[model samples]
Target: MSILRLPARQQVRVLLLSSLVMLAACGEKPQQAGGEMKVPVSVVTVEPTPTEVFVELPGRVEAIKEAEIRARVNGIVQEINFEQGSDVKSGQLLFTIDPAPYIAQRDQAAAQLKNAEADIRSARLFADRYAKLIKANAVSRQEYDNAVAQAGQAEAAVAAAKAALQSANINLGYTRVESPIDGRIGRSMVTEGALVSAASATQMATVQQLDRVYVDIPRSVNQLAQLRRAMAEGVLTRSAEGDALAYVLLEDGAEYEHPGKLLFSGVSVDPGTGQVSLRAEFENPDQILLPGMYVRVRLQQGMDEKALLVPQQAIQRTSDGLNSVYVVREGKVQPVAVSVGPQIKGSFLVYKGLNPGDVVVVEGFQKIRPGAAVQPIPWKQAGAKPGSQPGGPAGAQPEPEATPKG
Candidate 1:
């Protein structure tokens, strides 16, 4: 019965089977259709972030509160009050010179002052008697005038003695050398019994305040011009108050925990170095930042009024060694070569070849090819902080390494 069902095609099937066997013998797999292909990938979406763009240059660290402790009065060092390299507060005594001589001078002034007071008392009594006698005609006018003049001279002498006493007290206080700043003190230049002078060029000890420090950075004119141009051209956004943002980085690959302000920029350019001096201040509550520690500083060109940005991983170098990013469009991957200028937040400021709403592939970039379709997801959903994170693992990842970006 089955044979009868296949009867119409039995002869035709026999001839076709003979041809297929011959083709199989020629060594080829049969032509197939309805193939299933799937690619496993993590995808990220692109979004715009208005962040300040800046360049980082290597900088030298400095202390805002630094002082060299020197003696104000010439004397022998009688006491060393502080240990070397220890922290000291402002006005704290660090060295006590031989104060016996100052104390003797103070005592002599005190003795002189008492004598002046006794003389003034005697002269005042005589002057009062003479005034009464002069009116009663009991004493000659010249004698009465002489008594009054003696009282005036005694009063003047007392005033001069008091002034001398004050001066002596000040000199006595100066015998103790004190620190003018709160900071770590260096090794003492003069030990106990060593003679020091008020006019010594070398200091008795050096104290540098590290609690608050300054990092002096040199900014090039070309770099400043680039930033200014970006702001004027509306490439950089303005903050709510319209000021640009700033960031700092320390040596050993650490980003400063706090954001800094651009304190001031030198109006004059250095002819020798061809750079302008830029200064920024930071609070060092823990006193961790030391003076003379080299660091790096970054300054925003300006806020990109409505800047467009994308994940840095989305960018790639093409075979031609040009910057590029892969974007998804019409259910296919399209390679886009962009002119990326700088990074803002966790993304980059694309100068050309990309727009705000474009779907750029941030994840699975290595496996993606031209014309390949991808799934798009929100970038922030992966936990990216604008300008701070770039090419890092998505979602609460640590900030990317910012190495003096220009």
Candidate 2:
């Protein structure tokens, strides 16, 4: 602690302190060139857009008109004219019962009718002769009365014979079995030789009209209240189109070509599932779509007048389920949270946290940190177009975790 020392060690300490002070004064400045973080990124323009929103529901294909074809008379099946599972017109003959028994009954009735006519002719002659005899007083009154009684009995016999013939005709008409409606018939339940009755215990076969088919979908009852509230606020509207358009996706990942129409909505909610039934109708000319086929329907819900769109690559969900995006401005990265809407065209409808003029960072995000300096490149020319495709739909899958080329 000596201030002024004549010793050699004291002078060496003073020279060392002076050298340290001079070096500190000449040192590098704060915020030097190497301190800045650099990141290469792709930028995309955020535009306010008006887009369509769709609600997806699971549904199964169904038939609009279905029925069980049955026999109306008791007889053995003599012939079957219609093919199994083939389309048939109304009143088309499907099956024919044996008409032999009915024919015999009809013939017997006709024979009795002819016999009655012959008896009438003889009775008429007798009655006419009696009348003449009575007028001339040539025959006894008792004989004339007997002839009149016989003639009246013959007339009653003729009427009874006519009634029998009419009943026979009706039975003969029942032998022909016809289709009640135009539809596609299922396989024949009874073979050519099987006997059927008007009152059979089991159904013969089923027929369904498939050209105009129905589809039933189930949705939670909670959606009803949500829809009503939306309508009151003018956020939604009851579809004016009688046939609200619906698109169907098949099991094989292909979409059904023609759109369907919403037909009816069930009033009663299901107690078990707390779901309501929604019915729709479609035209199936090719008969390719069948009942019970699992499908996804895209129901057009409503449209948004002003919306924001963002590509899929630009948004990422954090571990805590918060949606975050990295935006680029003046070669700097900023993380922002956004609210997303329905997914469409491999992109999302951004409802909040973005504006029309902001540039969003799409690529090189994993390597950069918040507030890091970045080399921002326009998305279109930086690389391949983002959100322009699905993830390898038909072809072989691209290698995962591979480094993308610059």
Model 2 scores worst on lDDT over the 10 consecutive residues at 391-400
Candidate 2: where are CA atoms >4 Å away? 1-33, 103-172, 236-243, 321-323, 327-339, 352-358, 381-406
Give the Cα RMSD of candidate 2: 8.6
Candidate 1 local lDDT, residue 25: 87
**For model 1, how does the per-residue alpha-carbon lDDT over 1-406 read when each residue is reduced to its tens digit?**
4444576679678778988999988997678886434333444554555455565666676888789888888889999999898999999999898999889999999888889999999999999999999899999999999999999999998998898898889889988889888899989998899988878643799999877678788877776776666566666545564543345676565677766676888899999988999877778877667788777666645454454566667778888878888877876778887877655445666677876677777777666678865655544535546534243211112212322122
Q: Indicate which candidate wins on TM-score.
A: 2
Cand. 2 Cα-lDDT: 0.74
Best by lDDT: 2
lDDT of each: 0.72, 0.74
